[model samples]
Target: EDKTASDLFKHYQEIFPHGNRNAASHRWAHFVLQRSTQMTPGKVAYFFASFCPISGSPIDPTPQTAIRYESGHGLPQVSGGQAEGIIHHCCWPCICDSLKFLRVDTKTVSTSQGPHQFRFLVYGNPCTDPTRIPAEATDVTCSNGRLEASVLSDHGHVIVGMLQDNQPSIGASSREVLEA
Candidate 1:
């Protein structure tokens, strides 16, 4: 049977009583529909990474990590176990890149050990616009021959890869990584 938007909305409300019918929530619902229509049901995997000159403190250098994602459209809601597995499997490279990006420092610090003193900064959100880094997050600096990157969102566990200066690196992987 065909369902109207309102019908779907009502069904959703019944399923997610806690959901607020605000603009953002409505948009999110629409986004789900759009993504579902475009996607073919199948297993998928992805990976990402970045490098920075700074080094995280041995004690607590890594930044706080959080995964923001969504699953389910035509299919039943993903179980907690499934979601946990997806997050666990997908979050590593992103976290690693984030740590790498946060550690780059332009001004060199003198240490008792080495000529270059590298300190790691906590990774924050990712941004398409490099001009704006999340307020709580530090900027990824690439001066003095250093670069760093952090993962912001891997919503669908899609893989993305890109080449920078002819170096092959994983950008975002969606299906290819899973196949591998």
Candidate 2:
């Protein structure tokens, strides 16, 4: 017999045992997808716990912040001639470390001013260690002003992008890595 959403929900509740419906459903989906595609265990597990396990928040992406270049040599200048970029937001201090993750990538441009930069960071799920930043990365400084990071992740064959803001109103983006 075909399983309905309710049936899937019931199965998830049984499998999760200690989690809520949302968490259970997510886990179940992850398990089924992993099994069906014969994906590696490490990648499957990584995908399942990519976001915060408890609060479902993306890992904080505030590690390296954008550098405010007075000369605007290598940065993306906005209409106001301001360079915007991404920063890492550490979650271990504020929230349960078990439920945070992050990832980021940035590009900078050189302007007549000096050096300008733009960055993107992703938070929640798969908490990233900024100190151990991946290779081929550009760092941004975030002490002077607010910054933002755009995140990209691939799941199955889908590429998803999200914008993480670090201003007065900072939060997660609703974007997900789904097949196009």
Candidate 3:
């Protein structure tokens, strides 16, 4: 089904009802349009993350964690089934601090804490025209680094492992899944 801005906004509202009623969801819907090929409300609901992976903070109504992403591959398995994709968010401060030492030539974002480095990868041809890039993207790679060992919420022992550069981490077992 072709996802319209209305569809996106409606779904976002269903999942995050307390968020900004119109403006914020409208903006978020517009942002998703650029990156997704087959977008649907179900997909949005399935992929959206409630917290910022970097700061582990609850995503704000304006979604202060402006850096949002959708990764369709390379995520840990979940109990219900494999996750088709992950929609994750991150704050600017957390991402900027992590990318300060990024070596673009080597596709690595290193941190000052030590030898920790993330292999950042882009799915398509690198965008040569800065103007062509989406205005919401913080970096070309759309990811800074593995801000934490895990990005999953405290919904029991449902999450595990380090998140891939562009993908958010989620590990679920049967115990963590509730029948819908």
Residue 105 of model 2, lDDT score = 32
Instruction: Quote each prediction's TM-score.
Output: 0.17, 0.22, 0.21
Question: How displaced is residue 133 in candidate 2, in Å?
Answer: 22
Q: What is the lDDT of candidate 1?
A: 0.23
lDDT of 3: 0.29
Q: lDDT per residue, candidate 3, 1-180, as tens digits? A: 444334443554443344332112222322332333453333333223333333333343222333332232222232222222222344445444222211111111222232232222111122333455455433222123321111212222212112222222221211111112
Ordered list by lDDT, greatest first: 3, 2, 1
TM-score of 3: 0.21
Go through the candidates in order and give the clash count of each: 15, 47, 0
Give the number of the best model, judged by lDDT: 3
What is the lDDT, from 0 to 100, of the residue 102 in candidate 3? 15
Number of the top candidate by TM-score?
2
Q: Which ten residues in a row have the lowest lDDT in candidate 3?
A: 101-110
For model 1 the local lDDT of residue 106 reads: 18
Candidate 1, backbone clash total:
15
